[model samples]
Target: MPFRPPPGRAAPDPRLDPYRERAGALFDQGEQIGVVYLRIDTFWRQTGGHLWWRRWSEPSEQVQGYIEFNGGGFDDFYQDAGTMVAEIGDWGHGRFPYRGEALQVRWLDDEESRQVRVSTFGLDDLQA
Candidate 1:
């Protein structure tokens, strides 16, 4: 068996659906770069949780491999954080909060209840 999902378990992960749009500021002071921190309102369905993602630009920001968001136990699948968006050129390959799953989101317009979900990150969100 090649890891086939059982019957009735055919429902795909929902993070692909940006139920809401989240608005946050980036570290654009010129003094810093890379992901300073991210803050998502909530995606309370699949795992019943919220997002308050944050990551500081360390000195070895570029040199480090996968910047683990190590502190303590956090959310499911995303308990550890890292520079997933760093040096990704334009866009990434898979759904963020729902990696390896068939989910995609163009934008997150509703943080309370994501009204629109997409399979790709908006061009603006994936700019250099």
Candidate 2:
């Protein structure tokens, strides 16, 4: 069954729903499942932006990826990261390829400051 938020609580970002099942399977296998928070900001030329990410379960494991902004914008900036992590868990069992590897990715839009809070869990972190 799909997940639902508690009464009076805000719903989760719909973009992440697709990966819940996959993440659950990983959890059952005793894999380390976590979330990745990404902060993105486009450059003046709109060519690309800085993409910084870190695993929620491991604070010291932080990395950056390249973001090339073409003509169109992204439906969700963190979608790629989420998908990458899911695939890694499914195929590599938490071991990611050299190209793109991460936990369930969520975008951070903090205009006030560049600082980002590393709190929050992914699908696997939820108790069934």
- For each candidate in turn, give its C-alpha RMSD to the true structure in angstroms: 18.3, 17.8
Model 2, span 12-120: residue lDDT tens = 3344333332212112123433323333211111122234321122111112232222233222232233334444354334332323443322233342112222222
Residue 13: error of model 1 in Å?
27
| lDDT (tens digit, per residue) of candidate 1 on 3-112 | 22122221222332221123211122222111112222221122222243322222211111111122322222232112434323222331223233222223223431
Model 1, which residues run further than 4 Å from truth? 1-81, 86-99, 110-128
| Candidate 1, residue 60: lDDT | 17
Off by more than 4 A, model 2: 1-30, 45-128
Question: Which 10 successive residues of model 2 have the least lDDT summed?
Answer: 54-63
Q: Give the Cα lDDT of each candidate.
A: 0.23, 0.28
TM-score of each: 0.20, 0.19
